[model samples]
Target: MSESVIPRPSGAQQGRRFSLGPALLFCPGSRPDRFSKAAERSDAVIVDLEDAVVPGEKEQARQNVVQALNWEEPGLDPATTLVRVNTASSGELDADLDALAGTELGHLVVPKCESVEELDALAERLPGVGIIPQIETPRGVLEAERLAHHEAVVALFWGTEDLIAGLGGVTARRPNGTPRGVIGHIRHTVLLTAAACGIPAIDTICGALADSQRLAVESEDAAAEGFIAKACVHPNQVATVRRAYTPEDADVEWAKALIAAFEQEAGLAMDEGRHAEPTVVGAFSFRDEMIDAPVVLQAQRVLSRYDATRQR
Candidate 1:
């Protein structure tokens, strides 16, 4: 997609910032009773109004969400609570928006998002709401860059099962449970596109509820690849996702030591009356590895993740 096709946020929109914690748990909108529990269990709760609810229950689901928003006690936090609306083509988005209008909810997860025009229309109806576009189809993956740049988009999430289903594939994973090659490609494409647009990317949910070990491995891979968060289908998966995203104790110490060493080296350079370049001026050895600007930046990222997890 060309840069011109991507619309920039307005000045007011540009000033707004949205972020979610590392673990986001999904709760069916039809099951309002579980909303509070889901919120308590995960860092953020996504009340799913789309696939989670059958067509017959969609209206009831919408009403349930509205009722939950109106509750005085144990109300959903506008910051951490998100609603996953149906696709624009589903014929239910209009009703979804109508139900959500004038509510305190400020965030939405738009499923099957494949175009900027769709987002533009949604933003027009619900002004000031942040959107996390869920890319699942081939067109969505190809147009991810354009979708990521939309002003309403606060983050990007890709769905593996839907993508595979859309492509007429039998499964997204191999018999051994590792993701198929196409799934990996789509995941990386969405991740890189979101990163390029300076927004967070939410990893797909782990459907295998009983396979905690696989979920941990996948969550670790997502974190290693720079995904800010992972979506969970069940409450039990939340802690595993959080643990994978959080930096290890050894990693935190190593990052701190590396940063200190770089600062010391830079100090010595300045004391010698040498000017430091925008990047690191020279390379040095750290823990038997050649340390450079990139290495220092990686260390800084580790510390940043560590700090974010601590604050959460």
Candidate 2:
């Protein structure tokens, strides 16, 4: 199949706002038959036009994405469906953009994103689409903060294998599956950069498809480190990722009790003529632990996540 010659949409909106759920699954773009199934099994589905498809099949894959994501009656929800396009330097992005020209798909995962200029070009070609820049190389890591601050960037994601290979390392993790020092630093760098930019950060995939235990542990660690979601290569990993991100019953109860206690304390202080903001005024003891501003915020976040999980 030849690349589609669709005309690029004009006057594309910039800096589109979008949200993603806790677990995202990547399905090869060439596999149109699995598109609906993947979307059903995951919080979001990424139709990959990059690494997953071979060179000869790229055109066919693009055609599949175009057909599957048709605007009038898309096989997948454009809001939650993401297409992973080829890197800016790969010379395939133009065809990828051409294929996606008129589709209602609103999100694209730009692999190996390393600079603001690259993002600027994408914005010019496909304005308003939420771009998730995948940081996997040394330059990408160094430029992460700048990339996160770009007006077109909606989220940041970090990859481990590519980064390790770029650095000429043998492995990104230790024997126990924990990230090595370098990989750990990069992970935190991406997380902190995204947090600073007020955007969500997605953790990389766990390639060991058969090891659900390891996937669970890694997903938990990613959630604890403040990642909004984890990317998975297989459908079976979706439940594990979602469970890891969801707040436990004990945690939900603690958050509720803490908020109630704080509200009561605030109400009493108001009656006594003391200023009570919905936040910590000073150091206070709750459940034998010192509850301060940060602790209160943590509790609030837990409740917020709990509520979101319930809604989903």
Candidate 3:
């Protein structure tokens, strides 16, 4: 089946704002049926063809993605589909993009992105395609600000495992306990870049699937640190990722209250009904900054997704 490109934003609003999804889809090759199940559960589907695909099976892996994209389903939205193409400088990168271009994938994630020249190559090759540049090396982290500003880049990703490996284990510990110390540093870099460019900063996957409790803790830590979403390797990890990325009910309520109070106060007011004293500037500082916007909106989005999935 021929591939199809995802829907692009209107020209008027192009490059001005990015709509970040709730989760980063991590597709590690398993079986076709396994992919189907994972796709259903994942908020975004990333058809990976890099590290996850064995060298000999790269072609077969490409074919699998092609076939899967053509398969009929209850009805899948192409907007949520992403294909993780090999890095632009890699030998297989061209073939990867050629095979999947024009398809219904929302973005092409370039692995090991370290320079603007590589991004320029990717942009030339895949015009109109969104890019998710994975910062998996020391160079990539250092070049993050430039990459974030790249014309095709819509988001930034931190690859913890590969990055630590690239750093020659300088900050890497046993690799079993927690990647937090290492990831924390890179995440801050990526987060700052994303914030400066107004793009989404995605957190790397916490590879502790066996222990759901631990996964939950790390996932929450990433979210609290300002990562918009996280990637997941296992189906069981999806719920944890979603929960971590979403705001709690209490947080949502507080946000709603802030919005209401701010609306009623018009930035400043004397709450005679609640208190005799006047509520002056900085009293509703949180609302002024729109920090609570995500909390309220994310809670609503999560509940809506639950309802939609339940109905299906």
Q: Over the stretch 1-312, how does candidate 3's per-residue lDDT look in tens digits?
A: 888977755322333344444455677543455676766887777768888877787787777776666554323345676778776555888787777665565577888889999888877777787888899999998899888887688888878777878877765435455655766677788888887877777777767668888788878887767676788877788888777766566765654565446446544343221221222323335545543334434434444434434443
> Model 1: how far is 293 from its true place, Å?
3.1
lDDT of 2 at 103: 86
RMSD to true structure for each model, in Å: 6.0, 6.8, 6.9
- Give the runs in model 2 whose Cα sits over 4 Å from its true position: 1-18, 71-74, 265-285
lDDT of 1 by residue, 170-251 (tens): 8999998999999999999998888778887889998999999999999999889888889999999998998998888998
In angstroms, how far off is 86's CA in candidate 1? 1.1
Q: For residues 1-312, could you state the per-residue lDDT of candidate 2 as single tens digits?
A: 999885533211222234476899999998888888899899899899999999999999998888888743337788889999997577899999987878888888999899899888888888778788999999999999899888778888989999999999999989977789999899999999988887888999999888899999999998888898899999999999999988999998898787777777665532231223445466678899988777777777687678768877
TM-score of each: 0.86, 0.86, 0.77
Q: What lDDT would candidate 3 get against the real structure?
A: 0.67
Q: Of the candidates numbered 2 and 3, which has the greater lDDT value?
A: 2
Clashing pairs in 3: 3-102, 3-103, 4-102, 4-103, 5-102
